[model samples]
Target: MTTLLEPVLSVRQVLTLERVLAGEPEVVAGAGQLDRPVRWVHVAEAADVGVMLSGGEMVLTTGVLLAGDDELQAEYIRSLHRAEAAAVVLGLGRAFPAPPDVMRRAAERCGLPMVVLHRPFPFAELTEEVQSRLVRRKFAAVSLSEAVRTALTGLITADAPLQRLLDEIAQHSGCPVVVTNLAHRVLATAGERPAVDDVLRDWERISRQAGRGEGDGWIRAELGGRGERWGGILLCGYRGDAATGRLLADRAAEALVLHRMLGGGSAHSWEEQSAQSLLTDLIGGVVPARQLLPRARAAGLPVNRRTFVPLVVRDGDPGRLDRILRLLGMPGLVAELTGRSTAVLLSLARDQDAEALAAHFAARLRTETAPGTVVAAADGRIAWDDVPAGLREAQHVAEAVADSAAVLDLPPVVRLRDVHLRGLIRLLRDDPQVQSFAERELHGLLREADEDLLSVLRTYLATGRNKSRTAQLHHVSRPALYRRLEAIRTRLGVDLDDFEQAASVHIALLAHDAQQR
Candidate 1:
């Protein structure tokens, strides 16, 4: 079985080894500093050997050169401290056969750990054992780093999605992986379902408290390029040393940055995709809503005991809608749907007025965006199971008004009641009987491909068959309009003066237009 390897050994861990324990080592000073990392083990006998050392090395000595001079012993300890050595192990056979107060006091003052072996121990055995272990660990760490790098690069080359990359990282780190924007909104996640959900349930608090470095088992690395930071990737609750976790996080960050640069997506695009996936699944209803409750919660949507308002906007921009939600301090999910429409699912408190909030959203959309933007909404639902039908109803309403929004005096938010006959036609547009009726009723004009007559008829019927209004709107004289209406009547074999005949043609035209859309 493969296990994670720590790159460096702490001084305390080094002392507990069986080979080092054979010497009966006892900590005489700086016991509180025993957790310091030891990079290597060195055996130096010279009194001024501190100059020949780098930091984090455990220096082993017999103290033979400083046996007679107390000042020299103190200076030696000070020199090792200045060199930033991890600790000093003194074999006390010839050098006073006991712990020296001068050196111990100096080490304690400098906060450098000092150990003394109380037996005849060979420094070579301890050094060989530790050195080999360190070498093996270092090699393992390098191997792990390379393994992660190769796996990530291979996935990138295969054109894997962002979630796949995160999953790969999570598998290697044995923890949940999260990608977030600068504001700490989680854009993507991968790992065990329950584990990822647990992380996301309290993500805001955790993100605020986590630094952009290793903390406990949480390691974070910035995801950006060209000297601009846009987001970050985190390894949450990793069960490994800081060094190993850091290596994993840094490698993952590099892969993520490259993925984004190689057209994986921007942070906003990733968020949009996430919303799209969830909303698509919700609307599709292939999976039951109860089965998707965990997903909704993990996506940062408040689902418990909240009123859900399902809305669809015709020709709406998802980005602008998301911004409006943020500006209003409303929690919602926005995503672009098919047919140039966008879906916005708002999670509101039970006390709030869903209709008013949806109207407010529509008002803001009209004010900040296009004045004719049509927002269609369904009745607010208090249960999660009702949301799918609500979304479908809103979509139906939006589609019903898509072609006639400019002419209809729709409220800020259009609902099913507001759509009337048009909504029914839209719902039945796909029916074979409706399609055949529309084709047969409009066959003459459709076959002619004369858009001028069709437009005149559409405007005339839309205006309650007001001939004067149709003539004026079409910029034609009454005589010319009469001739066109006569031509339309002759082609469709219907009487323009008869109300029932005109209504039948009007319904056919609406159904035809709906089908075309």
Candidate 2:
């Protein structure tokens, strides 16, 4: 869960009434949310009760409802107020010279969404608008619970590969599927396979074009990226259901984050299984990342900050994640489980920056998911070959493997990519460059040599050119080490004697292998 339910904007809610009434915005304190559309108009023929309306509801009268006495004119205007109408419009030729001034003053007391119309508005449009809003509301409710169940299902068992998952999700949602970073870089894609690498590139275009006050299905939401994290959003969908998109997008975001989290985080077996099941089920079928956005809008809710970095939650009632999203901007905290028992999470306040986001996620995980539930956050922003950079991808590698392993031992969601490196190494070995380097440059070193080699190089470079101690620790005869040194020089094609070359080799070689491993 990555979002907190924001206060429903009353202005827009009122306009819903206006559009239904076929009324114009005569007056609105906060014009931003209103000034546009409404679905309900109070058409009352009673006394001028238009003043009673709260606002944004048009009052319709035929004057027949108050046709008789001059003394009762003021009473008629009062009725619009009773209906809480937006504005009162005297149907032309209905009453004598319109109700007395005394009645209009009373109508002015309350700021109503009253509008006078020269003609009777079509009521069919109102009905349709009301039905549309209702439909939206219904979907919103469905999406909320659906998000929870889906999160659990993603944690369930699955045999599909990453491409299959993306395909299914896109088919269901009727939109493109993309996995992005805080920088809006597309790490992977599902629907628009033809443009897989364009995810980030497109994000750049959409982010620049997004604007506020546009209440279309297409929207820009902020995901927390303060610190070393990825924050982004699903820009648009064909249906333009912003409300539905919020619910669906958050689930997808959580799934990705939890999927990433499981590689290194802690989660119980049951929790892990549930999350995978939902993810598999959701993506395995036709699923759209923005499926729930429309529903959110109908519920009179506002979605802020599209990028909700997910925290993976497992067996632990991933519902907590959904709840956390609702609580995020409210009380300043949120959390969830993406793939069932695989991972749990929390989203902090937007003002809280990167370090704060990470810190809050860690602290909240300790409070909710379990003590020490949050282990580490890996971001693609790190140097592609650096350990810190690979940490993020490694976690996902672990997740993909764990998802496969989930078919057995009740499965575990805490995936560590290194566990699968052996298989990958075998695959990459087909490349002669990789094979030769492993056989020659890294030869004589144990299987675990890669890990220590990087560490040793890092430390060795830190110590300057110190051969005697380097040989002593390598546990080698100094002369024998010298012979090996000459061998290293031959394979590496650089002089260890050159200060710059030594440092460069250490970083370039180790960092490169670390990423692949």
Candidate 3:
């Protein structure tokens, strides 16, 4: 967890104020430490004022009480140092006219900023001005915190998606907001497209170099609860004070954790959602594939000069498939598309064998799932523009074999060639002529609404009209199977022994099933 620093004015900012500038304040020591945050201002003339002070307070005083005591002057600076004061402001008048070397040297050695007022100025006025500004700043910070919290809470109540929450944070921070899992894989991003792309382009390097402490305008807050750290949210290139940035990051983190808990989604589920959105857009083709390349790279996918293999697995568990990919050290994106099909895109180096890797993935899936699981894949595509077509082809192949996987002898990885006629029927299922033909050929059986006969016909047609095999698989006697086949033929008004008619009925049945799936 990143530490949340309270909103405060820095010593440099305080010195630049109108009231402080009227006194012609000059830095006598610790010039490099002007950026130290000043929590408050205190006016004191006591030599032992440090005992009454706390850290982050700018001490204001004159040399009226310590003009003749060299030891006390040096000790005063040391006391403030030990007390962790932000800086010391002294008026050069009365007891001493010039900056005290004893105190300046002491402050320089301790690295405590020391300033001397060349002209007389009222300490009360400077203190009052600084205090009022500090109070207003603190109030504004609190207001900002509540405003962000309220906005995020309202979004959660309205059931807004994770992306919406990220966008809200980005709007408030005015910078790119990135959410990543413990492995540093970017799950989601929200901001200007170009800025987000730039951050993602160098995400790996940046994430690796980011420390637990904030720096370089990057503030990170861990996203987790109940003593478990799963991921983090980063505010990249936030052009605000460190304190303000910390506040924004901490608020955003709290909101994100609450959103996840309320939605009942694990961090891994968010990753899956991210993959689903990306893949859906890619397959939709509304956005050009080139525009999505940076997102792909940011999501930890290898897309440069790689062979892209698109696969659609019917009834495959996405979590299991992802684990298998990781176990095999393969780079891929897995997401559940519409229906029971899940899409997996493999990005293999050009030198690697895409076919062998896809086959191995299918084999592992079968071992983990069912032996008859159909993994429909398209031919390897080298160009990104060809990915949309590849995904569509794979999906068509999966749907083509979805219903017939039980009877058909399919390889572990089924390709378009393996789907053959079924694949062609799936592609044409939406054609008006094909739909009318399927309905006309099967009109009699469709009107009857006899599921028993429909099942018998589907099995018989799927088995290439092999009577004995269909009967055995359906657990029926040959005589009974013949009776069912005759009933189907009579209902459809087709000759039982006609080769061309049976082939036509089989094609119609394939088309009908494809349309239904």
Candidate 4:
């Protein structure tokens, strides 16, 4: 069975000399000075005993050599003070009948704690007792460090998630554990007392403050692998001593780095993963922009210093896009969204134009996918905080472009304006009025046994009401096409020849298709 020692085993505890020595010790001087830590215990009878002490020691002596010599005793006390000893214990008996007045006055003036033993005390026994306790505390600290390392390493080897590892660390350390990217975004947290949000609510301020201090209440260690730093782990309100906290942080960091390294993929791939997660979150709009800053930076995104160009490519091959990105030496995150669409957060130089960049990506993507691929770039370059809005805009454009049919003059870089009518319809697809209008207009055709008449109308509208082309495309006689048109007009209560009416019906159709998609 293993037993845990007191968590706090500071050098200061040895100041309780009576308990340590098992004899009543008289405080001859410096009563208020006993608060200093006794790092070790040393016994000396030599006159120049101060030379042997490095400091933080409670020196014990019988004073057998300097009996009744005021000058030598005062000098000895002064030397101990100069050496920064914790306290001085004068063993009574042969040394003197009682504590010397001159040495006591000097000690009092110097504020060096002086204790006089009232009875004969075995110096060796005191040394053994204090040293044993100190040694036990050292071993206990080593045990705790090993215990923490083993627990975290075990979890890492078992394929535990990052949050689970942090949870274990927090459980052992009894404090909140936070993992963040270089940009200072909170990635995961565990054992957050009072709530995780409370710890992260002011992360910016807290991080800045913690950065300026040295192990005050918070401790941190960098998480790195493959010579590239991923981020860091932070512990708030750590209860252990500074040394132990550092050890724990180091072990946790090592485990975290190793876990990432062994999880499959390289640093570049992990960088993409990080970016993909951040971009997905931005598109989702679930997490705040400020919260994503650190992750963006740590993921090799210039969140602080560079402009971001949000881009989306629909119905394109992701592998081709990834290869193109690698060839261009552009670092960005690419995530496969729902369907055939993919989202990208491209980091651009501050002076680069979003249009030029988008055009470059579009040209390469179109070459890869061939025939056609809709590439939508956000209106302009934006700050990291504004990237989410850009993502939304780019996604809107991509969806609109995908639903469009007669975009004959396609620009390399499509935007909201490029999508025109189709863009507006896609945006409003979910609006109550749009849905009601689509249902009301297309209700008859939607209820048909077959979509023959619907296809005819679609071909006719797509051909700008050109009877010849519509009939030829549908492989039907002009009269047959006319009949289908008549059926459409009757069902929708509109004339296909009227421009305004045809435009309305076309928009409704586009919205219906977009909704289906």
Candidate 5:
């Protein structure tokens, strides 16, 4: 309708589009001089072409939108051109002339893309270009918003994660992709790298050097003006084009907004905060690296590079590790323990990748722990300038794995450790759906409760069958504690004294921490 937002368009965008019509021109606008500062494309059936346009969009016509004469044809073309139509394709064999002189003059006047689709031209070819143009014209933020919408819907409705949506976008570009925050911290990534789970490992060491930057194919993008601020980098491999960068930035902004709304100090910290919260309490940190390494090595991570790092824990936090591995494109499996917590085990193809990721995990753990309390490893020696956030993600993944396993499942998990409990926690925690029942029922409480119910449960568990003690620790009384515990048992349908059932509740609480971290 009415807005302050502007659309971005480029000529090359035409090639990446879907078919607009059956006989549309497979027109290729290589000049890349299409009108910018556009709004959106719409099919207007109104008689006056100019009046119908909201701006942007290459209007497709059989020349029916224009009812003007020879002189008016030029005027009409000029009118559409002035409205900033990126391009105008007039299909031949329609009422409009094959080579309308008026369009030529207007093209010269406004420099808008003007093409006359010859009769019988396959619209499929033309549609791809149109789709490409339309996609590029979009605000990358909007595209990511769409992705977020789809991902969230999929997360709840079809059971998917943001990673799948990101993978889809990366697949579209046919290159490795790094999605970052507004400050350029990578939150998620896809495609091959020197190693698994090393997103900006050791960024504080290298990235601190002003503008050494992360990820290849990501050049410094000037958004124009002070306070213009970088939206973040979008790396493109060989198949990546300039549009991919713009789209990545858009997605970056959208993701930033989503994470910010998730609760953080600012746009930059939102991704980190949300991720920290999501993986924080998973017993064994997330990663399926062991299962994934063979493939990553197959791709080039470990050909002659036998060097490795161990994500040590007695067992692993599969969900936490899964998030990390999912982010890293690493793979592993989760397993459940009969008498212990879940666990996970994975490996990075290279050594430095392991070290860098270890650093990220360490920092996140500091927020909730004492120093040297947690350990995760990464080892890869690639160009340090590559994706710093990836490294950080690797770090956090290591933390999730090491901490989760030690605290909840087993003591001290390792890539090669007998951390079956850690591994089982990871395997069992892999399915957040198990907690979906609590999540839905607890929605009303999360919105209304003055205290965090999850915290209450944890505190109560710590008190060891002593309601008064737990209440005192929580700054509440026995009555309040009892009331809350009853609600939890009722909502969750489990008893604290029933050792097997109570353990599931503990895991659910851990899972909640996993989601937030």
Candidate 6:
């Protein structure tokens, strides 16, 4: 059965020929064949009629030119096979009272469908009926294409989310719909009848092979407009005809591009805005956890039964982090918090420890980020309701460690508990009293003296007063380094050998740097 919205073709089978000719047509040879598309209905009386057909055409003839010579008839059938005709319908009576044996044997030998008209039938009637049906089907296909475009456009105007739009397309096409970035990360998915997880569980491999071949049962359409390509929309397990699958994928892509444009502002992509908004609101803490839970889940976080681990990374590529997350199949939200910082919220299984996960995450990012990059995470995992606090805590640690002597240790995961006194000083960096204390303690160093003394002081304090390392770092002799250190102590009115004075100087330096950042 063919619906008005389904693709149409003009291929005729032997069964269809019998039906069209009102049971007068009988399959005399190649009787068990009825499947394959027909191109057109053709009629010719010449001996070399096979040369006239392009392919897949049902040739209606009287066998007047193909009669008598068994060898000639066999050659004619072979020529039809070479030309790829659909079937041969021979009319009986005037040309031959009975079906010709030579043509019947030739048709069977060549495996060409041979149908004989046992009763008187006009060739014109058969041609007219088949041609009209083909025309109607072609027009129906056009109408269906337009209808899909209209439906998808209407959904776009409704401000439906990306997943909802994909769902509708899946319903129409009876397949799964997947939206992916150019890096092949599954951004959103819909229309998997069993479950979306089933489709996405192996998305990395599935997306790699998508649109390259038919064995994968996938089709793709480019998903961008305005002279820029964003990504692609994939149709998985599309059982419909190839033409209809293309139509469905293209319509879905158009709707997605339109949805992104309408939902996003001029400056940021819709995905980026969605990530930033959710993260910003989470840390802002005005909205209730229950209210925000739905949004988090909709954004693809497994928030219900999972632990929330908040992380902040500095000096790393946010794009590369995003791609790695997708490659590892980790469910998380990553967004740029500042030009030099990126914030992340990772969802881990209930049994997983946040410390271990943070270490792994930081280690992976360390290889890709610039040297001296700092990755700070919350001290421990928290429940979903406390995620905002967790995010703020990680952000505080990241701020505390950025450009500070603490990052010299390069711990895999810097935590609030790990930064010690420096973290506390950084946390209080904005206080008027703390700013005054730093300015007072380091006023002499801040004065126009050789800046090398300040560098030596910063490095010497960072390395726990290791004079040899400090000298080697500054490419100077031990006395030269000692001279710089003595100058720093004199400027700050502190003793390098006194632990209390050294600690005060360290805290002031940390506060000064945090405030600058």
Per-candidate TM vs. native?
0.74, 0.34, 0.88, 0.60, 0.33, 0.50
Distance from true position, residue 510, model 2, in Å? 26
Off by more than 4 A, model 1: 1-6, 11-35, 45-50, 60-82, 87-126, 137-161, 164-168, 212-214, 224-228, 258-265, 285-308, 326-331, 347-353, 368-371, 381-389, 424-517
- Order of models, best TM-score first: 3, 1, 4, 6, 2, 5
Each model's RMSD to truth, in Å?
5.5, 16.1, 3.2, 8.0, 16.9, 11.7
CA lDDT, every prediction? 0.88, 0.43, 0.89, 0.75, 0.47, 0.74
Q: Write the per-residue lDDT of candidate 5 for residues 359-380, one digit (tens) a residue.
A: 5544443444443344433333
The number of the candidate with the highest TM-score is: 3
Which run of 10 residues does model 1 get worst, by summed lDDT?
Answer: 1-10
In candidate 5, stretches whose alpha carbon ends up further than 4 angstroms from where it belongs are 1-31, 34-48, 60-71, 91-102, 120-191, 194-517
Tens-place lDDT digits, model 1, residues 460-514: 8877888888888788999999999999999899997899999999999999999
Model 4: residues with Cα > 4 Å off, grouped in runs = 1-239, 242-270, 280-295, 304-306, 315-340, 381-385, 404-409, 444-502
lDDT, model 2: 0.43
* Residue-wise C-alpha lDDT for candidate 4, range 208-244, written one tens digit per residue: 7656655465888887766878778888768766656
For residues 1-517, write the lDDT of model 3, one tens digit per residue.
1125456888999999998999999999999999898888999889999899768999999978888899999999999999999999999888779999999999999999999999999999999999998878778888888999999999999989899999999999999999989987889999998999898878767787654554568888899999999999999999877788889999999988998899847899989988887888888889888888878887888888999999999999999999999999999999999999999999999999999999998888888898778899999999988998899889888989898788888888888889889888888999999999999999888754677888888888788788998998899999999999889988899985788998899899899888887
Worst 10 residues of 3 by lDDT: 1-10
Give the winner by TM-score: 2 or 6: 6
Better of 5 and 6 by TM-score: 6
